[model samples]
Target: QCTVQLGGSDQWGNITAGTDLVRRVAGGKAFGVVSPLLTNASGTKFGKTEVGNVWLDPELTSPFAFYQFWMNTDDRDVIGFLKCFSLLSQHEIGELEEATRVEPEKRIAQKVLADEVTDRVHGETGLAAARKATQALFGGDISGLNASEISEVFGDVPSSELEKSRLGGDGLQLVELLAESGVASSKGDARRAIEGGGIYLNGERIQDVSQALSIEDAIEGRYLLLRKGKRAYHLVAVCE
Candidate 1:
């Protein structure tokens, strides 16, 4: 007397087969809803990053990282997502549109998009944790986070381990250091990166190629965050 059907766009043929089977065997109309395939701005499949497919589990992505991903969406995608994922009132959405049109840099729409999706996938606590981590990382406020939280926030970045004894010795030159830590390939490459202003340590651009890592610069006594350009991040950890 009743039937349920579930399928993605790719499975439409199979769904029709099921409908045919049902009509012949039980003589009832079959209904179906097909989900469209999702993609990114470049039209690549969604849920994938440079690292790989993004996992839905909180343990895998952390709520903060997930939230940031949504918050960084291109302007073109925001309205479409509002329709697909949000329950916001039409009035609220209209206001968001006005805000976006007036000052896109404020990114009100992107924040709402991120907040809604993060809450749905990871809950409020997860969203909060993610927001906190993002602020600490991007806002240059790393003082309050415990070691575990720091690790969780920077977990996906490229990392290299160094011996604790190495921390006390003469520090490495910027070029040799970056190369030795696997951030760059050679001294020449490191110099090029620095000259181009592509290298940053703890969020500040490093202009001097001769600069070296020192104990005072380390975070929580053992880690350094190195950024290249706008988005490439690498972590250097000193181990005992």
Candidate 2:
């Protein structure tokens, strides 16, 4: 029998039922505490929508994605979020808020919030994995990630499947692939972009317009990551 039940204001009915039952059944005193629902700078209550909900289950939302979600919090909302979701002291949060005000580009507050909240929900090992994935993706050096890690990193990006045989013999031309996979507007655009040194295969810049994707280019011989410019991405899955 808990001495107190704490939940969001929306859970008042549910929590009071438990507290009342404890008093009635065991003649014991129990307390129910309901706090207001946390929200961002916008009035949208957190965790109420499906478009950007972060789930506790790693399958629904990988630890890395969860960490990145917090990392990307808006500057206007980071401090309030830290106060509600993190265990940092008021002094530390004050420092972060000051940092945010003075050097918002550094994203100090968002980083701290992401780190503490991710570590709390996912623990140290999961936090480590999240950090590794974050580094691999943002650093543009994903060669260290295995197939599953690659999938997790680009799971939301547009993708298409290719026959495993496409990589046989001479392998597939990079320009043809860019068109087939819809990474570029057309093969000509893909070629011109390659010439401009903008296309990246598995994270490394590909300057050669003649480059071809071989089995060696595939991570674990299962997937290939193609990047256009800084943020747009597409995944090519090799299948039988």
Candidate 3:
């Protein structure tokens, strides 16, 4: 008889216990393979985005988000992740490493990592859907998507809905809008943030406090992505 067990790093002690039990009771030696503990560059345990755990199931973590997560992996971790997840041979992996070292902007390792894992968990169809969603998101093209797809892509983004009437002829001031959306705590703070080069609108840096949201700038006629610094992000939805 054989058994398979899957667990995190902390479960090592328990795993050994189970192996010992199997050997003593069944009169057969047991073997095991332990996966490396995933961690961030800071050595903290790896987890999902600030939201929760990274799940292999598409229902739990959408394919697009999963692809983006892998795509954004640090240069330092891409090789290790590729080795752990891809079906590539050792020589192929070595070649990938060489390519990465020689030309990181090519991001060959990261692309392979994203493609293999995405295909495995979400299948080819899902991978294609994810790639399309990613392109629409970063490429500033949103005309082809339906509402549901739009929701799926921006689900985790911090968003605030606004009434269409409120966005009348005079568009809201940038500083006031930032504060109202909780992107910044106060107008003074918002001004400072913009001046400090910490604010972005739709992926482009917005250094002017006088700027206002235009109907043409909305993604899918509803959403706007606002970024603060390198990592903090917010989404704004305009509702009719």
- Per-candidate clash tally: 1, 0, 0
Ranking by TM-score: 2, 1, 3
TM-score of 2: 0.85
- Tell me which of candidates 1 and 2 scores higher on lDDT: 2
Where is the poorest 10-residue window by lDDT in model 2? Answer: 42-51
Candidate 2 runs further than 4 Å off: 1-5, 13-31, 47-51
- What ranking emerges by lDDT with the best candidate at the front? 2, 3, 1
lDDT of 3 by residue, 37-142 (tens): 7876656677655444468887888888889889888888888888888999999999989998999998889889999999999999989988888876766454
What range of 10 consecutive residues in model 3 has the weakest lDDT sum?
44-53
Candidate 2 has an lDDT of 0.90
Q: Against the hidden true structure, what lDDT does model 1 obtain?
A: 0.78
The residue pairs that clash in candidate 3, if any, are none
Tens-place lDDT per residue, model 2, 192-217, is 99999889999989898888878988
Report the error of model 1 at residue 165, Å: 1.9
lDDT of residue 16 for candidate 3: 82
Better of 2 and 3 by lDDT: 2
Worst 10 residues of 1 by lDDT: 45-54
lDDT of 3: 0.80
